[model samples]
Target: MKTGKRYSEAAKLIEKTKTYDLEEAVALVKKTASAKFDETIEAHFRLGVDGRHADQQVRGAVVLPHGTGKTVKVLVFAKGNKVDEALAAGADYAGGDELVPKIQNEGWLDFDVVVATPDMMGVVGRLGRVLGPKGLMPNPKAGTVTMDVTKAINDIKAGKIEYRLDKSNIIHVPIGKASFTEEQLTDNFQTLIDAVVKAKPAAAKGQYIKSLVVASTMGPGVKLNVTKY
Candidate 1:
């Protein structure tokens, strides 16, 4: 892979072997974000758990204190009054029978998040094969599947995010944009770290959080001292 000039310069600024404190890492990430566009800042976590074990799975949702800088496009699966409620609550697209077919036949997926009312799960279930892989499937645990379509849509629009472990036992989540104030980014980072820590499975042994790295979209990864969190 060929490296860009800006990325090479940014990488030079970070000590490859040094693990920084939470605040120091956050500051460095912000300082190194030299993209012309406001790049998104993300935190990647390597957890000590077997993702294959159902009980050891680390998955849940949290609302960032400062919210993700990007606007979320929400799609709601519902019918009747709930459909109107979803749209009124700012859902980008809301429907039921029509939606399932459009996605099933046309393969249309233009939304970021998917919210489905409980009653419509049966219909939504058919699209699991498509949405699941994209992490857009509405799950009860993530609060994306519920009776209150309005609240679900509003919460998603307000920066509620779901984090789940990947096959490699790593979780990558965006905390905020590079343009966010250091204080705002730190607050969001702490809120997510607290949620991940509290969600530790009893079956998880040894160090629950193995490693953590914070980085901007185009900047080099800044390793953080997990103990500092």
Candidate 2:
């Protein structure tokens, strides 16, 4: 594959076979960020579990200590006084059935996270076909589906992120932006890794975290040696 000159240069910084420690990996990721805009720093984990099996499914949420360095836009599905509660709690958009056609007809999905009250689930369920595929569906496990819209919105704004194994048994999530300090990124990284470790399914066997990689949005991946982690 033909790669850009900038990408090639960034790739050169990473040792193809060497696995770096968490600190070194984060530093390398930040150093290799060549984008003009603030690039997102992401952590990718290759897990051993098969996502196809219901018993081996690994998924959960964790709040980053330093936050993800991104302003999360939140949409709340609610009715009666709950709608007002959501907006007051820092929800970017809050409404009921009226917002349905706007999303279905206008293809309007301006928010990053979706939070719904227990009662508003019926109204929110109408958009399941559209939202489910996008990973925006509010699930109880991820703490997005709840009656406490305020806490949900606050947690989301505070950098709560969900991690789940994909078809390839890999989980990818952004830790923070390249513009953040190394210490800030490291804190978020540790928090996420700890959460992923604790969320291991009982049915999963063999190695849990097979491989770990950290990289900037436009940079090459730097492998992390988590054997000691």
Candidate 3:
């Protein structure tokens, strides 16, 4: 793949062999971002666990103190009064049966997050194959499936994020935007790091956090010294 001129230039600024401390890595990522629009800063973690084992799965959610610097369009699956409650709480779309068909037939999935009430899980279950692969399925563990529709919608809009290891035992989370101050980004980074550390599975052995890297949307990745976190 051919690298763009901006990307090539950004790559030169990073030391390929050196792992930087959290603050230095965050500052470097912001400095290297040259995108015309506000670029997102993301943290990628490589965990020393087998993802295939059910006991070793690492998954949870957290609300970033500084938020994700993006508006989250939320869809709520609920019936009757709950629907109105969700919308009043700032949900982008709120419905029950009507939504399932639209998503299944028209394939209408324009929202960023999906929330469902416990009673609506039967309906939500039918769309699992559709929403599951997209990571849009409402799961209880992620707090997306619950009776408190209003609280869930508000939290999600407030930058609550779900993190889970992929097939490669790696989890990628957006800490904040490159436009955020180094201090703001650092706080978000620390919050996520603490959460991931606390979520370590008992089945996980060896180094829990194998490696970590932080980068802007269009910038080269800056490796972080895991021990410092």
Candidate 4:
């Protein structure tokens, strides 16, 4: 994994051994993002809890005040008036059984987030194998599976993002783009941290947030001090 000269230069700006405040880390991340395109700034959380334990699992969603920079394409799994309701609510693609084959056999996956009505779960269940592996499966915990299609669609359109722990117990999520102002990035970053901290499972003992890091798509990781978290 050889980094380009620009990436190497960007890496120089980050101190490998020092932990920074959230704002300072975000500033460095923006400065180090020298890519021609607007780089996505991602926040990586290394949690002390073990993902293997059911009680310790952490998963939820939040709508960023400033919103994630990218546009979100939503696909709703519903039927009857719900399908029409989903479309009217701004779902990019809305339907029932028809979407199953398109995603399974045709491999048609031209959407970012997937939302399904409670009753439509039966149809959505058919694509479990296809969607599960890709993390596209709608879940109640994330508000992707609900009876209120309009609210779901509106929240997603307004920059709602899901955060869940990976197998390593780390949660990786995009806070904003490098083009975002430091204040905006800091606001988004703090909002995400507050949500995660609040969602902490009682089963999770010891240090909850082991490490926090923020980095640009093509830049080196800048560590954030967890003491204040």
TM-score of 3: 0.97
Q: Each prediction's Cα RMSD?
A: 1.3, 1.4, 1.3, 1.2
lDDT of 1 by residue, 1-229 (tens): 4348888898988999999998899999999999889999999999999989999999999999889998999999998999999999999999988888789889899999999999999999999999989999899989999988878877888888899999999999999999999999999999999999998999999988889999999899999998854
Off by over 4 Å in 1: 1-3
Give candidate 2 regions above 4 Å deviation. Answer: 1-3
- Compared with the true structure, what per-residue lDDT tens digits does model 2 show for residues 47-150? 98999999999899999998898999999999999999999999999999999999988999999999998888898899998898899989999999999899
Model 3 Cα displacement at 171 (Å)?
A: 0.2
Which parts of model 4 have CA positions greater than 4 angstroms off? 1-3
> What TM-score, computed on C-alpha atoms, does each candidate reach?
0.97, 0.97, 0.97, 0.98
Q: What residue pairs are clashing in model 1?
A: none
For candidate 2, the lDDT comes to: 0.92
Which numbered prediction scores highest in TM-score against the true structure? Answer: 4
CA error at residue 132 for candidate 4, angstroms: 0.5
